[model samples]
Target: MLSDMTATTLDVPAELPFLQSLSWFDAHWRELTPYQMLQRYERGWRHRGVTADLSHEEAAFLRGLIQRFGSAIDVPA
Candidate 1:
C-alpha cells in the first residue's frame, strides 16, 4: 500500500506586530491567511493608505524582506 501527501511551508516572522495592527486584517477578519499577510506586509501594500512611523531597523528589515521576496516581480524603470 502507498500513501499520498501534500504540504506547504512559509517562512513567516514569529512575531508580526505590525501585521496584527492593520485594520484591514481586523475588518476582513477571517479571510487573510498568514502567508497572504506576510506577502502584503513585505510588498508594502499596507502602507499605501497610511504613513508608517517605523524606526531605522524596522525600515531596513522591511526593505530587506521586500528585496528578497520581490525579486521575482518586475519593476518599472
Candidate 2:
C-alpha cells in the first residue's frame, strides 16, 4: 500500500539562499578570524547607527571575541 511505503529523501541543492541566511554561521562568517569578525561587527554598527544588521547571537559572538582577544589592541591607521 502507498501509505505503508517508506518515504525517500529528496535531492535538494546545497547552496539554497534562504537556508544560508537562516543559518547561525554562513560561509563568509565561518571564514573570518575572531579579530576580523570583530572589526566587521564594529563597522556595521558604525554605518547603520542603532539598526546594525547583526542579530543578537552575532553580537554575543563578538562580545566573546572581545573578551578573548582584548579590545585594547590597536587597529593600524
Candidate 3:
C-alpha cells in the first residue's frame, strides 16, 4: 500500500500568458516596482503569517525581483 502512494510532482509551466495580460500594477501589488512588490509582500508576510495565497514559485519570484531591482531598499523581514 505504501509503495503505491509514491508522490509525483507535475511540471507546471509559469503563468507567462496570464502575466502578460495584466497591465502594470494591475492588482494593488501585482507588478509595481520591485521595491513596492517587496514592500507589499513583506507587509503581507508580517500581518497574515506565511504566504498562504502565493505559490512557492510566486514567492520565490518576488524575492528574486527584489534582489534584481530592490536590493538597496532595506525592508525588514
TM-score for predicted model 1 compared with the true structure: 0.35
Candidate 2, run of 10 with poorest lDDT: 3-12
What pairs collide in candidate 1?
Answer: none
lDDT of 3 at 74: 38
Q: How many steric overlaps are in each model, in order?
A: 0, 0, 0
Model 3, runs deviating above 4 Å? 1-28, 48-51, 69-77
Give candidate 3's TM-score: 0.39
Tens digits of per-residue lDDT for model 1, 1-77: 11111111334444444554443436663245543544656465446436444444434545544454443432222
Give me the runs in candidate 2 sitting further than 4 Å from their true place: 1-29, 49-51, 72-77
- Provide the overall lDDT of each model, using Cα atoms, as 2-decimal numbers: 0.44, 0.42, 0.42
Can you write out model 3's per-residue Cα lDDT over 1-77, one digit (the tens) per residue? 33222222222225423222332345543434444444555544543323244445654565465555454433333
- Cα miss at 2, model 3 (Å)? 55
> What TM-score would each prediction reach against the true structure?
0.35, 0.41, 0.39
Clashing pairs in 3: none
lDDT of 3 at 32: 48
lDDT of 2 by residue, 1-77 (tens): 33222222222233323222433455565444445555555544444324434444444554555565556423222
Number of residue pairs clashing in candidate 2, backbone atoms closer than 3 angstroms, sequence gap of 3 or more or interchain: 0
